[model samples]
Target: MKQPSIARLPRMLKLVLTRRAGFGVRLALVGAVFTLIAGFGEASAQAQTQLALKFKAGDTYQQKVTTRTISGGEVAGEQVKTTLQQEMLISTKVESLTEEGAGNLSQVIEQITLDIGLPKGKSIAYDSNQKEFSDPILASLHKTLGKLAGARFEFTTTTSGEILNFKMPAALTEMAKNQPGGGMMGDSLSEANLRRMFEDAGVSLPKEPVKKGDSWTRKASVKLPIGEVTSHLVFTYDGPENDTLERIVVSGDVEIAPAEKSPLSVKLNSTKLTGLTFFDRNLGRVDSSSMSQVLNVTVAAGGQTNDLTIESQVEMKIVPPKK
Candidate 1:
């Protein structure tokens, strides 16, 4: 073959490199945004339903969470992972529910055996009792970081369930205040932000006349720091007295760019309802035989589609104290 010009070769190489780098950046950005949206949506849903449950003291329940992520239409090859084990304890007063422990992938699994005392107007306190972890490195780091980061944290929360007011040990608070993006400091929950989100979404509680098999769908237009997104929340009451939420389906479309958007959506379908029980007299209920199916997770930025399916069942016994 005839010798090619060096100058032409360099120009072609530069163009190829530039194109590759741009593609990589776009892919990363799309993935990050999708992950954030999924996570935020789940958190928002949990906060909204947290207070709706009429749980009494001495009531306890356990739940397991399994999650998997798919990108560019391919199963990230990682099997379903058990994210956490949840233990919810309800106190005599409505504001005293406590979450015992949570397991994270990176850090040591710590038992958050803190009791929440909801005094008045979103004022809350954390009384840490015991600490347990399997990893030695994590334990040591947690001990040093926990104290340095204010072992005990308290704050006033926002209505959207996002933490707004944070009160940490003086030393930790000062340190965080000195750092950038440290506003979170020592806050645990943010009720104010959550309430604001619900307000913007035009979400409302189901009216008292709610009966079995009644379903309601609401549309929420959310404006995040990055962009605007729309979400649909569909709630259905499968049992009488609205004791159990038989089905909850969430789906939405998000705009990734001016000309491109994600037809991204998710549907949590129910297949079986087992161990479903309710005690209206005492404000207690349990659904030991409930299962859900997640289907069709799509990302439309790079012309890729990933289909994901999730099957989960939760079992628990909740007994409310005498009213």
Candidate 2:
């Protein structure tokens, strides 16, 4: 008997493919997450000593980025590229000081305007920008912030029209707590779990450690629907006291399939960080700085190998809090 076509495969096989596709997209998104957190962490760690680093106060920063996406394996046909120039303004106001460290931040606001340039033959066009794009985006933001804690505003314009909205989500408040390097559970982990894990790791952050080449590593098993995935995260610090986070590297293998599923696997071997900068607490501005990283991803299925490359850069201005 002849083998059946892939389209005629069993439901279970189809489900496997669907899951793999979703996993691929998640992997790509993970790269972006790494970039954001790595940069955020370096800056936050360096600025930890800055006076009055409390909530209910506002600050603004500017970031410029140049990123490129390259794909192979199943995604070989598509080429993705974008250049982003943007500004971010953040403000906070304490609504009620219920307790010394536990008060409600009533007004938390963020304003972002980005100029996005897409590659030829690929463009984003929409009518009723507010209804089509702004609403959903804002809703997600608000849900992410909730009743108190985090808020944001996004406005975008094309030659065609404009987009504007606001959102507040409580989860953002939690994420902000880990600002810079907290991973997946940074936003959702309970305080008790966080403390327990920190203690288990024997992690002790100094008020000020002599700035030098410092590195830390962690290994953990993450439970997924398919199976348990082992993850390893490595953080590296390279910078003088003036600027911190010279580099960061993360490498790990995630089990994409089990004994019954297809013999497939996904591996992420990426080193995402090159240069970083710290905000001048007194100056309230992004000190001049730059960062770069190269990432490689490999996927194996049915004895076939697919690979991809991602390169990214981040440059930003440190500005003072509004008066």
Candidate 3:
């Protein structure tokens, strides 16, 4: 073969080297993109299996709650019955969190409405937003309920949603401050009951990761007009129901416990509680929740006993983050 020129040799080698380098760079870029996508998919799968609150600061939830109670059995061989209904608007925010994942939250009441049926075909309704009411008693109660608006309460909880500490306010006392007979409804709005109403409804996660059919138990002592009630809240994991949501089922029982001696006592009572919640892993919170309770109770007072049954329901959902 004839000898080639030295200048042409250098150009030929340069072209070959440049082509190899470019091919390697393109291969590396493709691999990096694939790795990133695979990592994202793996993280999502892990989240669905893991059970924990893992709350972020400043997250907020809006809740609508409704409660209906009908308590009627027999008093002195006469049938007696009454129905009570209540609706509320509540907002919950995670104020701050601890290194161990515990969190402090601020719960605010925005609105409240109530309807109570009285004897002899009489019924009264109270709406805090109403400017005027026909009955003075209803008007007074409306004004009392107004105090709840803009009320903020701070508390701490475990990742599982169990209430660790509650800054319970003198709710009934505050609601009754300017009312004519604050004392009559004061006990019915006691701090203990209100605290449980907000806290116990929280999502209680399992100690360990759970799959379908897994179950756990939680116990709480709540005070109500019928008396102090100790309840056992049972939780069941139905596992991952869909791409973004996890389903949890709840059922519980409440029993009258020995409490302070007072006319406010339950002679006999039956209780049942059921609930379901859907959690969004990507959002890191419950998307929506619904819970209901039924109570059939016999209330005893000075020389008399009254039968009562009550049904209560609550639903909640996370709202978009504040700007």
CA lDDT for candidate 3: 0.71
Separately for all candidates shown, the number of backbone clashes (residues 3 or more apart, or on different chains) is 19, 16, 4
Q: Judging by TM-score against the true structure, name the best candidate.
A: 3
Error of 2 at 312 (Å): 2.6
Model 1 lDDT per residue over 1-323, tens place? 98775455444344544464678775775566567768988775544233223434333333222222221224444333222222322221222333521111111112222222221223222222334545554454344334432133343222212222434456654544454331222121233332332232112235333444455655544333223334454555444445443332222322321212223333222222222323232332223222232333332233443454433333233334324
| lDDT score, candidate 1 | 0.34
Per-residue CA lDDT of model 2 for 1-323, tens digit only, reads: 99878697555455555564677776665566567768988987755232112223232333322233333334445555555443434343334332333223322333434444566644332222122245554444333233222243222111111111223344544655654323322333333332232122211122233234455555544333223444444434444344432222233333323323424465666545455444333433334445455557676666666675656554444345555
Q: Taking the tens digit of each residue's C-alpha lDDT, what string does model 3 give over 183-261?
A: 4443444556667777654677875877677788888776543456687888887877799888889898877864465
On the 0 to 100 scale, the lDDT of residue 205 in model 2 is 22
Return the TM-score for each candidate structure. Answer: 0.32, 0.38, 0.70
lDDT values, one for every candidate: 0.34, 0.39, 0.71
In terms of lDDT, the poorest run of 10 residues in model 3 is 179-188
Candidate 1's C-alpha runs over 4 A off are: 1-92, 95-189, 192-205, 217-231, 239-323
